[model samples]
Target: MISRMFSRFNISIGSVTHQIFKKPTSLSRSVIARKFCNEIARPENFATAGTMNDVHIKMMERIGLEPGYSPIPRSREHLIQYQPSSADLPPRSMADSFTSAVIPLSSSKSLQDLYVSYLGHVRFGRLMQDMDLFAVWVCHQHVNIPNLDKNIHLPYTFVTIMVDKIDFTDFSPKGTSDIRLSGHVSWVGKSSMEIVVWLEQEFEGTYKKITRALFLMAARNATNTGPAPVNQISPGNEHEQNILIGGEERKKRRIDHQKMSLLKVVPSNYEQSIMHDIFTRITRKDTIQLDKRVLPANGKWMADCSIMNTIPCFPEHRNAHNKVFGGFIMKIALENSWVCAYLHAKSRPKLETISDISFEKPVDVSSFLQMNAYVTYTEMNFMVVMVVADVLNPTGGRMTSNVLYYVWKCNESVPEVIPGSYHEMMWYLMGRRKLNYALGLTSGV
Candidate 1:
């Protein structure tokens, strides 16, 4: 039965692609194949492995043991040093960390019900959550610490620092085919790893690409107290070497972008001119009066296109480290931004791309999370929405947790968004930069 299931799948690692027809004699040798049997066939097991703690608990349960029934001491004192050098661990190949999972939406009614949206299209936000989880799992596969007992829990904790980008194609799933999630650890730094994951759906006996995502993750100690060292990546072939080079370029771009942030530096001459043009179009020059700005025809004020939502971070949404799951926060932010775009366009919007998402801080599990979404920039049918997530404290103070940017495309052209204040204009410029990046344009209004 396992062999029959394996015959229908194709796995790609770097530039190499192969089909596995024979089932592995041992489950440890083929984690993806085992995942196909345990997770694709039974979606309930996928839900059980949502977090690392859950994964460990489920494994214990599979061995006919109760929860917290560990024979070895799961303490920090008994194990090796908390911080291991890179030399202490062996370098891993890109294929060594490659992993894949299947969401059989076509065969499983329950999965379809969970992933399909009201418009009969698969929910992109839910897929973002899955991608985030899959990236972490791939990193775990790459990391191998030395002198650590197998019976005890892993001493390293992987946390997502940022998502470099998520680019989507025109292919949309109709809930009639199985979706495959595959990725590998493409690059590794001293303590950080770059994971490249892609999504595809089975179509006419072939897999059609849906989207690709790049995630940056950092390793921390078991208690989430400090940085932990991770294994290095050994590029085995030319294709893998190119992937490593791309990762280096991405890291460089991120640094350059930070150096040019609006918060630190003034806007460029071109950006300032664009802002001036919008100001002149909306303001009356004849009067020397305050508040002379008036909304132009076919224009919507940036502040007016705002949407807000508040959610309580429950324990169920916490990750293995008892902090709010980064994926949950991403899903919420995307949904909020989608609503903002929908209201601004007065039509259902299709997500074109999600720009770089940086997790500023981890939210407490019991905190109240608030999200503010604003349509900051628009060009014809494309709208750039920014979602700001903050954790609200009991004393009425809030700390920024995340700032996400998304680009949405409507069926028809939408009204232009005009910035009224200086801060709004900054947001407008930032939104334009993000939209340009998403659209693969170097410069644009």
Candidate 2:
């Protein structure tokens, strides 16, 4: 059976072109020509053999992890570091056109005018498995900052999700919305620089803020030799002092325009840079692996928060301060929970349990959020959507919310990654992938 499954993946040199939305027709199969046996397919039982496992684990980490780091968020204020390398960067591609989408027509919409007014940064979540693999694998390429002439775009496979900023808070699929997405590179680089991008939405009569990301690039060598040394800034540090001094930022200011300009503004030392450090060039990438995502709703309600019923983020949904009230988010979340379970039954299922929910944090009125649910663990006759609601920052950065909802998947099987032959494929299947990587496995599943 396993052999049969693997055979489906084979591709011959001379085969027919693939079709649209259908698996390919021709696949080359090989015969091991051995006898059949009943045993586990996994080569190593990761449980025992602590010593050997540790050795292999280190080796895997060395090769498995990408080089460079998550790019640093530009400081509202400060001088950053720099890295240098090839100047040419990958270009960004945009949609030739977008389809018209209709949002709810409301009379009393709070912040309605501002909901999706101005646009900036965007990161399309995973669209499919292979694309997701490529997305994760390519995080290390760097590009210059100032020369980052256009938007910073990267592609990943996903189903339905749009995270953006709505006035004061971030906006997501709050109410009914039709969001179309495609993929391409906004910026490409070898080192010391990268282009960045952002996005927003068009709704009713306004456009909203999507997300903004920057890529300060640095060039890497088989060995290390460049305009400046690499910066190793610690990521996610609110403190300014911990930032790296050399990488993309340094490369940005190093451009003299002339080989030996009359004036050289960049200091000779790497530590002199106050804005960036090694950590800064490292882009903070959120990997959403479909399978590794465990919300723990066994036989519980499940809603693919990315693209389900639009949970409104309006005035009636807010409090006295004009901010969207936490209570309203909770109420709507729970109600949506029931709706998800009902959908799972192909109509409606018995609402056996909510199991649990937590408002991890206040989901502001204008905040853009993407809520995804899953049945992380299960027991016979019971399952749930371990719900997760995440907030997106104006710069297209995301933060976890104070809320969590366990939607029930009343009638569903233990989910698994759509299987593939690559080690990366198995890794994702085994839940070894990242959180954002699972955007494709929605409640619709």
Best by lDDT: 1
How would you encode candidate 1's per-residue C-alpha lDDT over 1-445 as one tens digit per residue?
A: 2233225335232211233334334433223322321211111112222333343354333222343323342445422364567778998877777767777787778788978988688888888887887888777778876666556666666789999767788888767578888778877888899888778889899888888888999988765677888888887665566677667766777888998999889988756766667777777878877478878888888989999999888766666545788988999899899989999999998899898899999987879999999999887688999999989998878999999999999988888888889999999999988877776543222
Model 2 stretches astray by more than 4 angstroms: 1-312, 345-347, 407-445
lDDT by candidate, in order shown: 0.75, 0.29
The lDDT, on a scale of 0 to 1, for candidate 2 is: 0.29
Q: What would the TM-score be for candidate 1 when compared with the true structure?
A: 0.83
**Candidate number achieving the greatest TM-score relative to the actual structure:** 1
Worst window of 10 by summed lDDT in candidate 2: 30-39
Q: On residues 1-445, what C-alpha lDDT tens digit does candidate 2 reach at each position?
A: 3343235334222221111122434422211100000011111211121222232233224223222322331121111122222333332111111111122213324323322322321212211111222211223222123342233221111110111111111354332232221121222233222222222345676655333322232333312222322222222222111112222232333342223221233322321221122122222335444333323222221223122443445444432224444434444454455454444444333333232233345555667766544333222223343445677676777766633324233344433212122322222222211111121111110
Q: Note each model's CA RMSD in angstroms.
A: 13.0, 26.4
How far out, in Å, is residue 378 in model 2? 4.0
